[model samples]
Target: MATKKTQILILPYPIQGHINPMLQFAKRLASKSRHLILTLLLPTSHARSISSHIGSINVQPISDGADQQGQQFQTAETYLQQFQRAVPGSLDDLIRLERGHDQPQPTILIYDSFFPWALDVAHSNGLAAAPFFTQTCSVSSVYFLFKEGRLSDEMELPHGIPRLEQRDLPSFIQDKENSAHLLELLVDQFSNLDEADYVFFNTFDKLENQMVEWMARQWQVLTVGPTIPSMYLDKCVKDDRSYGLNLFKPNRESCRDWLCERRASSVIYVSFGSMAILKQEQIEEIAKCLENLQTRFIWVVRETEMAKLPSEFVEWNLSSGLGLVVTWCNQLDILAHETVGCFVTHCGWNSVLEALCLGVPMVGVPNWSDQPTNAKFVEDVWKVGVRAKEDEDGIVKSMVLEKCVRAVLEGEKGEVVRRNAGKIKRWALEAVQLGGSSDNNIAKFVTGLALKD
Candidate 1:
């Protein structure tokens, strides 16, 4: 007789970074157990991108009171407010309907940590709540600390957590202008995490061992990541590289072909992830740094945010072989490419883990949020990257950008950075291999998760 399918319901916070890992885990879980049925609750607009990546899995798009065409709000704050208000009803309807179905009722709801509201929804519906964190376990711990009012400038944070000044948190929480409206959301992310029956982190033991240990002290946390594509982790799965989820339609060939022509480890890969909007002066400064370096570079700039660039510099780069600026590209493919040397990134946790696993040295130009803390770890703790210094105005000047880039590529420190990145990659590969800590943790979670009889 066949076993009943474990209907696992997953709800990711509506963003590419959050969705990608949760979806990857869903795929991983499905691949590991044939006796499982997976359903994802995604924003209606994002459903296509997700379906394209993992079409075999079940996906039910939730209407966030937005257009059905996938268009999202211009700002995160407004989007979160609207999304939080719109999602509870859809969740209630789906869980209620699924529980009454002929198949086994949904066993559990794995919701992103950012949407702590998911726990309340899970509680109301009698579903087990599992909070899945897409950020670094270290960052997740820090957020929980922030929520408890346990963090202060004078207090020394625990080991493995970045010793950040109170002002160094995400811009929405620390910056006077942005934080005023969105600060509460930052706290809310961790508020409900503890109430979860199972807590998940897209990280592994040894990667952030101290943080993982500390996090488990309060709640039994499971480390089940670098929750990335199986291909990158050297799993023996075909077509596993295409996570098939991108908010932007990436032109991979153009970027891949461009990367091929560049000398090995000579290209500077620069991206600020999906959300950061750089000031015009910052953009111009970066332009000058690229021009001054005279090396091959690829920069991902959003189309709407392109106006921040100096028109003269933009036109000049169009003609110069020094840089290639596209709105978006397959970031993982680019990182894996041999020609790419150093990454200049915004230090989003996914990007941080990706760079580490790939063994690419970094020039961290952190903007806001956990980025500063991640940057500190990259430079001070991991010894795999250098953090670029910004001026008093909070913009990394052209000179600082130039120096950090050069340091990672040619300076005396480059050798050590490369060596450390190489060392970490080896450990990361080991962690994801068969019976590795990450692999075991995920397998353990799968075997133990069950539904009410």
Candidate 2:
């Protein structure tokens, strides 16, 4: 009789944040299990980047023929259609690539929550498929709620719910027309989750005990979080890997030098995640507000120019020596820096976790999707941040932005927020230590997935 082999194929949604977590999970699996062979199904563009950062794992770039169009690739719908057409054939190709090897074929498909087609592909191929929820368990519950028709409208959530809002819904689920189709797709996809061996969430059980319990009653749910720490531990014990997975080219020197000059806990760092684009007017407003506050800041401004800024406004801080603006920066490193006091953020999950881990307070400026809910958690529940108000036009005004910045930086409440953030940071660090909830959950997840064997 032949020895049984376990092959796990990981297919992540082709975006930076999603891809990063999936890669970390793959790395963790690789470290613990020799019986498991890992194959990452990635975009052609991302293949080289991911491969460079990860260890001895096979990266198979899916060829959709759409990538040949290059710059012409416009909408999400187009990418989805192309991916749907390509993934099945790509999976077959990967299987063929594995067949001549001295190992078993892929027995499990580990996929992102957004990729519903993975379930279909895995079922057709007689393989178990596990969905990886990259966001918080709270956010995932909201998604499941929407699918169950618990929420009537998309724009604004029904008011009396103590813990959540309609804005907590995922980006694609924010529109009624779009959400109808999305909920239908999610319902179909999630209904078959029981067929999968297990589902993995990038959050610890202690962090969300209620949601984890609810999910466990439905399907096998494994909570594994702060994957970065796990990756760091792996590096420390194993190969001394300097970095995990980062797709974007970060601006490092400028921000670090700026941080070096500032006093400890004095500079504010501001960044919206990659996808949130600001209007030229909005950008100008933010610039003006930052200038008005007269505090030292490190701002990540992706776009080159803003139309509404006066000529003087553009030149206001060019040589002012108090602000450092860059297109992108090494955010994790900056957050961990001593001089960094607060974050003015778009409230993406990864950013929130990073801030919490570093004990840095924030000025929450939730742009869209689940960000408002994230803001609510930070401001209301965590007591680590303050929310900026939206004007009558529902736009966040310059004055409001300035006020929130000042509140986070200098107000009496800011001191309280700072202390709360520090406490959360201590708890976050403790959670990752031996005997801590996050540490214990990782072990449990590994054992449940049979990766420990």
TM-score of each: 0.94, 0.87
Clashes of each: 3, 1
Each model's C-alpha lDDT? 0.82, 0.71
What's the TM for model 2?
Answer: 0.87
> Where does model 1 exceed 4 Å of error?
48-55, 67-74, 450-453
How many residue pairs in model 2 have overlapping backbones?
Answer: 1
Instruction: Put down candidate 1 lDDT per residue, 1-453, tens digits, no spaces.
Output: 667777889998888888888888888788777887888888776665455336446888877767543465777887878788878887888888888889768878999877788888888888889988787777766666767778678787877766676445655546646576556665676776667888888887888888788888888688888777878876644467867577888878999988888889999999999988888889999989998998889999989788888888888888876788899898889999999999999998889999998999999888887788788889988899998988888899999999999999996799999999999988888887888887788788887864333
Worst 10 residues of 1 by lDDT: 48-57
Q: Give residue 356's error in model 1 in angstroms.
A: 0.8
Q: What C-alpha lDDT does candidate 1 achieve relative to the native structure?
A: 0.82
